[model samples]
Target: MSVVAERPVVAEESRAVRWWRRPWVGPLALVVVVFVAVSVPRYLTLDPAQSLVPPVEGFAPYYPMLVAHVLFGSVAIVSCCFQVWPAFRRRYPVAHRWIGRAYVFAGVLPAAVLATVIGAKSPFGPVARVSNVLLGLVWFGCTLAGWRAGRARRFGDHRKWMVRSFVLTISTVTNRVWGVVAGVVLGPQLETTFGGNEQYMTSTIAGLTTWLGWVVPLILAQLWLDRRPKKRARAAGRSGVPA
Candidate 1:
């Protein structure tokens, strides 16, 4: 077969085996939906001066951290949202690489650093602090791995690492999810209506998000990556090929 004829076949096969088609779409869509749902309120209700947790000073801690949070958060969200879209990956490989780099440098690094530093003094508790730090580190690692994988042309590995990166980045989405749910369900009534308690609601929400947000991605990654060897071994056993 001519190289040109084989190119499309190779690309199609690659995308089919990319592994984001099953079950990954659900959580990624959920995060997007949640992001659109809460973003308007977050912007309209912007008050960067207040502390979601503590270690409050003037603008020293809160503002810088929040700025980093929003900037990096935006990169992470955008990168994650498009990482699995094959059309985008193929049609805009250069753009994808650029965005992916931005996600690592602009998003993952700052988010990890600020999350670690700010988490220590959070009013949410030790569990929340630790979870945030851990999430930050993991997300950073994911981005780094994605970068390395892409550099080495390990495209499948790149896709997997990017999936994990986006999953951790969805911590923001998770935070907002619990914040909204807690307000509607768990919060005390204020004159038979909700009013101006977002920060309070999100206090513990951050920790819950950090810990639980990763559960889906972790399980998916383990199944996707690790299950292959087991499956092959079982087939080998049945065929009596080896071992």
Candidate 2:
């Protein structure tokens, strides 16, 4: 067969083997949903002095950190929405690389550093502080790894690591959702656990959610990636192709 004829056949086969039809559409929808659901309220309602857990009234660094976290995190979230879209990646590889660079350096890195600082200042105690630091470190490291992989031209590794990093970044949205649920469920028990000190009770809840929010999404991503190869192999076998 001629190379030109084979090209279309190969492209068609690639599309047929894909995990989803138009995967970008669903995720793009989700990206918008998450922005509306979490990011909007976060900035709109932010009042440093009235912050529930950290109580930012007396702090200087906290203000800058808070601003950096919100702005840089927004950049990361929006950049990732484009980064993961198949149409964007395939049709605009140059743009993909640029956005990925911004996502890592201008977005995740700054956000994670500021987060570590803010987490260290947690008013609740050591538990919240440790979780925050750990989460920030992991976020920073995963994003850096993805960038390095892209530079090395290991595109598969780049995608996997970038997906993992994006999942961690979006924990900002998940963290808030979990916090609301915890507040409602644990409202009556605040006095029982913290001697009626609402500040400490809020602190405890924040600390727990900090760990749960990032950890859960990462675990789910790991499971999905691990299954991907096996699923692809099964598909290939059914099609009488060598896995």
Best by lDDT: 2
List lDDT for all candidates, in order: 0.68, 0.81
Candidate 2 Cα misplacement greater than 4 A, ranges: 13-47, 50-53, 56-59, 191-194
Query: What RMSD does model 2 have?
Result: 3.1
Cα lDDT for residue 134, candidate 2: 91
Stretches of candidate 1 off by over 4 Å are 2-59, 178-206, 228-243
Per-residue accuracy of model 2 over 36-133 as CA lDDT, tens digit each: 55544555466664443455556777865776687788888778877877766776889998898899889999989988998888776788789889
TM-score of each: 0.68, 0.85
For residue 95, model 2's alpha carbon misses the true position, in angstroms, by 1.4
* lDDT for each residue of candidate 1 in 1-243, tens digit (9 for 90 to 100): 699998997887677755465465667667676665555334334565343444455446665675567666776676766666665676788888887788788878787777777766566767777877777787778879988998999987887887677767776776656557655664665333425565545555555665766755566766777777788799889988673
- The TM-score leader among the candidates is 2
